[model samples]
Target: MELAIILMILLIVVAAAAIKLSDVGLTFPFSKKTNLYTPAERKFLQMLDMAVGDQYRIICRVRLSDIVSIRPNTSVKVSRSAMAQAATKQLDFVLCQKDTMSPVVAVDLVSVEAERSYKAQRDWYVSGALDAARIPHIRIKAKASYKPQEIRDCIHAKLAPLRFQQPQEPLVRGTLNNDKAPLRRPVAA
Candidate 1:
């Protein structure tokens, strides 16, 4: 009788521990979505995006100018402050150009899958773009993420401050350089 009671109590304790552990484990609070910037840095990106007037437009001419920025009120509520590292960009510096000051611009585009290969290039490109637009920005980078609509809204929100029209000659693909026999050498070398 004593052994049976002891075994039953042990089983009950084990089951209770497991139940409690599961309750904590299943919460998964840390599994919340990851972002590339902090709330503040996200706000900066949105502002910069707006100032640039959709130079990085994606397919369908769906300008990212409609995205809204994160409000200062909610910066504290965001969790990803650890990635708020500052970036140093060349365009942010001053260069003497014929006794005149001019902003520098550069571009290098890649699909989302190649992000790791050229992440530095991407950041510098964007920072240069913002500089070309004369949008003053903090030097810090942050981690943040949002839904597609939210991204769109953040862009739009930035664009709202400026007045501009769409470009007539939008970018389109051509096959001039895509042909198999793209070149021929001079007859008399």
Candidate 2:
């Protein structure tokens, strides 16, 4: 009887407190983000699109874990630690094959000052991990403007070996020797 009354009063008090907090706007205070990319990043994304054209798909703000994983042979503890670390770190952009969606290149946009500071520690880890996985990492200096052709040239140069490994189609239907037959004009003379 007495115990039941006290329990009922306590429950009502707790519920009242929660309702008051909600009425005061203390719950669900978050709002939607306005923009996904900063102005500089937006500009670079446009330039990257122009540079790669239809050759590759561009993924922005990719997590390291999405690109690489801990070895299967690793112990549980080490794997947990590696995953935790990878989950927090992210790459600025990743270029993937359009057909297979396999990540081929990782790009990081860094300011001159960030490159020289403690941020370099993060870069070192990202570089080592990508290197171990045999993925090419390209660091680009963020600036006000970029030339798409230069970006294309740089990407092609790095991907030269990959391009050679893939089978290429002939430019013409037949062999070059047969494509154009030489004329024997002096036979009649």
Per-model clash counts, in order, read 24, 0
Per-residue lDDT of model 2, residues 58-177, tens digit only: 999999999998877999998898889888889989999999999999888776666474234446778888888888888777778999997888787887886788789966765447
Q: Global lDDT for candidate 2?
A: 0.85
Report the C-alpha lDDT of model 1 over 1-189, residue by residue, as the tens digit: 999999999999999999998999788576656975545444544544554443453121111121112335555534123112212222221211232323222222222434464333346544543554554222222334424454445444544544244445546854556557666657995
Candidate 1 least-lDDT 10 residues: 59-68
- Taking every candidate in turn, the Cα RMSD to the unseen true structure, in Å, is 20.0, 5.9
Against the true structure, candidate 1 reaches a TM-score of 0.26
Task: Give the range of the ten consecutive residues with the poorest summed lDDT in model 2.
Answer: 113-122
Cα lDDT of all candidates, in order?
Answer: 0.40, 0.85
Q: Please give each candidate's TM-score.
A: 0.26, 0.73
